[model samples]
Target: MTVALMWEARAVAGRGEELLAWVRAQDLAVRPLRRETFRAPQDRVLVITWWDAPYDADLPELPDPDGELVTRTVHRWRFEPVAEG
Candidate 1:
């Protein structure tokens, strides 16, 4: 089953653009089938990656940017599609 990984982070104060650049420059160890990134109010950044592996598979996740760039710890979630059968 394909799995989707979601990663999110909020930048400190007025460092939203900096945080976004850092996230854009990151290189994943394992390339996903599909990947996308977005930004929202409150200096937040979100990234979603779809992989062709099991939900519990060990996949290389984007490392956290420098602490100074973020306000708090990064958040992550994993999900798999429900089978119709």
Candidate 2:
């Protein structure tokens, strides 16, 4: 099975680009099979990484950006695909 790690954060006021740049510069300890990034309204940034492991597996995650760049603490979630067989 494969797992997905979702990390999200919201920038403080006009610092969205700064926060996004920080996210793009991160180096993960464990490389993922694939990764994608998204931007939303309200200065929100979302990153999704796909890994070849279970949801409970230990994987390297993106650390929180500097305090001045974000409004609140970072949020993260793990997910697994439902089996059809």
RMSD in angstroms, candidate 1? 1.4
Question: Which whole-number lDDT from 0 to 100 does residue 33 have in model 2?
Answer: 99
Tell me the tens digit of each residue's lDDT in model 1 across 1-85.
Answer: 8999999999998888989899999999878999999999999999999999987999989998888889999999999999799
- Candidate lDDT scores, in order, read 0.93, 0.92
Worst 10 residues of 2 by lDDT: 13-22
* Clashes within 3 Å, all models in order: 0, 0
- Given candidate 1, what's the lDDT at residue 79? 92
RMSD of each: 1.4, 1.4
Per-residue lDDT tens digits for candidate 2, residues 1-85, read: 8999999999998888888888999989878999999999889999999999877888999998889889999999999998899
